[model samples]
Target: MRRYTVSTAVTLCAVASLAAAMGPASAFPAAAPPAAHAVQQQPAPPVLVDCLWKPQVHPGDFMLACGDGNSRLASLRWSHWGADSAQATGTNLVNDCDPYCAAGTFHSYTVTVRLDDPKPWAKNPKMQQFTRMSLVYTDGRPDGFRQTMTYPLWS
Candidate 1:
C-alpha cells in the first residue's frame, strides 16, 4: 500500500510539471490589421487666424495650444483681468522633459499665468499677440518650469 501511494504521487507530480511547461491555450483569436481602404484618414489642419477675445467668467478655464506639440496649457482660470494684464492660474502640461518627452511620462505643474495686453505681431501687421506670460507655481512644480514665457500666441 505504501509503495502504491508513493508511485501515484510521483506520477501526478510529473503530469503537473508537463502541463505547466506547455502553457495555457489561448481563449481569443489573434488580432488582424485593418484593410488599407478601411483605415481612417487624418483630419484637416487647424486654421491660422488672429487670436480673438473669448469671454470667460471669473474662475473660468481655458486651454492654450502651443504650435510646437511639446507644450500646452492644460487648463487656465482667470481671477482678474484689466486693460493691461490678466491675473490667472492654470496647469502647464509639458512633454519636453529629460529622457525624451514623447512616449515618456508627461509632467504637470500648478501655475499662475499672467496674460498681458495684445501687442502687434511684427511678422503680420494685422495680427495681435499676447505680449507676455508669467507662470508662477502655487505648488508641485516640475524642474523644467520656467517662471515666465513670452511669445506670439500660437493658440
Candidate 2:
C-alpha cells in the first residue's frame, strides 16, 4: 500500500463525512402537480339585501338584513350616489345582551355604508346588481369590535 500524506487523508475523510451527512439522492423526489381534489374552488358569497323592502329598495332609506333578525340598518343618509358607487352615513341596530341575544334589547351604532358598481352575477351574466357593500363604524363599537363589514351584493 502507498503511504498517503496527512493532508490527503484529512481531505478524503471530510468528503466522506459530507456524503454521509447528505444521505441518498433518492430521498428527494421531483416536484409534481397538486391533486385536483386538493385544489377545490371556493363558492361565491351569498347576495345581501335590504329585507325591509318588498324587493324594491327606496332611495336614501334602506336596511341591511343581518339574517339572524338580531341586527339591521336602522337609518341611512346618502351623501352621494354616482354611477359606480354610493356613499352614505347610517346606523346599525344590533342586539344588546340584556338576557342573552335572543331576548336582548337593540342598540344603534353610527356607520358608513358604501355601495359599489353593479356587476353581472356569476350564475347569470345578464342580470346586473350592486357588487359590494362596505360598512365602517364611525362611533366606537360597544362590543370593542373594530372591523368593517364588506358584503357581496346580489339581486
Candidate 3:
C-alpha cells in the first residue's frame, strides 16, 4: 500500500513537470484579439457642481449666487469641455441692487468664462468639480468688478 502511494505521487509530479516544460501556449489556446471595428468608450469629462450639488457639463445656465440667485451665467455656449479646463461664451446677469436686493434690477453683460483647477468634491469623493472660475468682460462689467475677474468656486 505504501509503495503504491509513493508511485502515484511520483507519477503526478512527473506529469506536472512535463506540463510546465511544454509551456502555456501548448497547454491552452491563445485568446482572440478584440474586433477592429469595436468602439472604445472614453471616460466622462470633469464637471461643475451647482449649489444643489448636481454635476453639470456644458450647461446653458449656471447660478453664481447660491444664496439668492441674484447673479448667474446665462446662454452659455461651451467651446471646450475637457478634463483639465472648460471655456464658454455667455452673458452674466447681475442684480444692480440699487436700493436693496429684493427690488434689484438685473443687468446683462457679454463675457468669456473659464473654469479650471479640478478637485474632488467633499459631498461626493468620486466626482471631480471645477474649483476656479475666471471671467473676462467683453462688454460692460458690474460696478465693483474689473475687466477680468477670478473667483474660487465652492465645492
Candidate 4:
C-alpha cells in the first residue's frame, strides 16, 4: 500500500506537469494557448472526497479514493457515471484515509471547519441550512459506498 501510494504520487506530479505543459492546444483551437491562465497541477499524495450531492442525497452512497496530501479539496477532479460507475484521479488524494490490512476493517476520517465570511453559494434560502459545512472529495468514484453522517453548524 505504501509503495502504491508513493508510485501514484509520483505519477500524478508527472501527469500534472504534462497537463500544464500541454497548455490549451486542445481547449481553444482558434486562439493560441492562453499564457495568462496557468495550467493547474494535480497535487502530490492528494486525498480527495466526492461531493455528496446529486443522487447521493437520494441514493445515499459514501465511498472515496485516497490520493496523497498535496491535492486541494476543490482541485481533485471527479465524475459520476451513475449506478456504481464512477472514476476519479488526482495526486495526494487522501481527504480521509488510514492504514488497514485486515478483512472488514473500518476507517474513520473527519474534517472540522469554521465559518468565515458569508458567501452567496449559501445565501439561497434552500442552501442556508448548509452554510458552514461542505462535503468535498479526493477522487470522486463513489458507487458501492454509503453515507455515514453530516454534522451540524452554528451561525
Candidate 5:
C-alpha cells in the first residue's frame, strides 16, 4: 500500500462535515420547553436560627445566649440580607455578673454584625442558615472579649 498520512485538521474537518450532514436536530436534541403554567419560585434568603430553632430573617432581636439570656442582639437593622451573607447594625446586650449570673446587670453596646458561610440547616435541611457570625464592637465590647469577635453560628 502507498504511504498515507492524515493531518489533525483534516480529521476534524471530516468529523465536522459528517455532523453537519446529519443536520442540527439529529445532532442535538431540542430541550423541553417549560410548562406554560409553571411559576418560577425564587429561593429563600439566608437566615439565622434562633434559640428555639426557628429560622429568622431580619429579626429585630435575637438572643445570643440561648440558654440563660446573658448575651443577645437587640434592635437589629439589617443593611444587607443576601444569599451569601448578611449584615446589620445592632446592640449587643451582655450581662455583667457583678454578684452572680442570676443577679447580673445587662449592658448595651453598639455593634456591627455580619453573618456568612451559609449551609443547609442541620435541623431543617431544606433551608439555608448562616454558619459564621462576626461582631465588631463600634462603641465598646464586653469584658474579657475582643473588639472584633467571630463565632460559629448554631445550625
Candidate 6:
C-alpha cells in the first residue's frame, strides 16, 4: 500500500488559520501584549491528538479501543479560558493492545482520529483546547514508525 506522510507545519498552520479565520474572530481572544524581555512567547501548543470516538464511552471500552490501535491509556490535558491547564499524561494509551488484532493488516501505516472533546468545544486562543500526540510502531525492521494526529483548538 502507498504511504502517507504527516502534514507539515506550514500546511497545518495554513489550514488551521484559514479555517479559524473564516469563522468568528471573537472565538479566540487576542493574546495580551507581550512584555518587554518576557522570554519569547511560547509558540501555541502543538496540535496534539490522542483519540476521538463517540460522544461517550466507558473507561474500559476506551482502554480497549486504545489497545486496538497499539496504544495504551494516557491522560489528556486541557483547560478553558481563565482555567489552569492540566494534563492526562503517562497512561497506557495503546501499549496494551496485542498488536495482532483481527482487523485488516496494513503494510505501510495509518492514523485514525477519534475526537471526544465536549460538544461545541470552544476553540479558544486564551487556553489550550486541543492536545497533540502520536503513535509509534515498528516498520518491520529496526527502524520505527511515527504517525501524528493534530486536532484544532476550540474555546
Tell me the tens digit of each residue's lDDT in model 2 across 1-155: 24567778989999999999987788768677788898897543222244542333324455555467776775677776554667778788878767898888988889888888666545556444467888898886648556587887645
Winner of 4 and 6 under TM-score: 6
Instruction: Give lDDT: candidate 6, residue 29.
Output: 83
* Cα lDDT over the full model 6: 0.37
Worst 10 residues of 1 by lDDT: 43-52
lDDT agreement of model 4 with the native: 0.34
Candidates in descending lDDT order = 3, 5, 2, 1, 6, 4
Q: Whole-model Cα lDDT per candidate?
A: 0.59, 0.67, 0.92, 0.34, 0.91, 0.37
Candidate 6 lDDT, tens digit per residue, 58-150?
Answer: 122223344356534334332221222223322333332235445433233223333333223234344333332233222221123344343
Per-residue lDDT value at 1 in model 4: 100
Q: C-alpha displacement of 80 in model 6, angstroms?
A: 12
Q: What is the lDDT of residue 134 in candidate 6?
A: 32
Query: For this target, which candidate reaches the highest lDDT against the unseen true structure?
Result: 3
Quote the RMSD, in angstroms, for model 4: 26.0
lDDT of 1: 0.59
lDDT of 4 by residue, 1-155 (tens): 99999999999999999989888676756755667558765322211123433221211223332232222322223443222223333322233232332222332333222222222233232222222323423333223333322233332
Estimate, for each residue in 1-155, the C-alpha lDDT of model 3 and write its tens digit: 99999999999999999989887885677777887668776657878998888999999999999999999999999999998999999999999997999999999999999999999888877778899999999999999999999999998
lDDT of 5 at 90: 96
Q: In model 2, which regions exceed 4 Å deviation?
A: 1-49, 52-61, 121-127, 142-144
lDDT of 5 at 122: 84
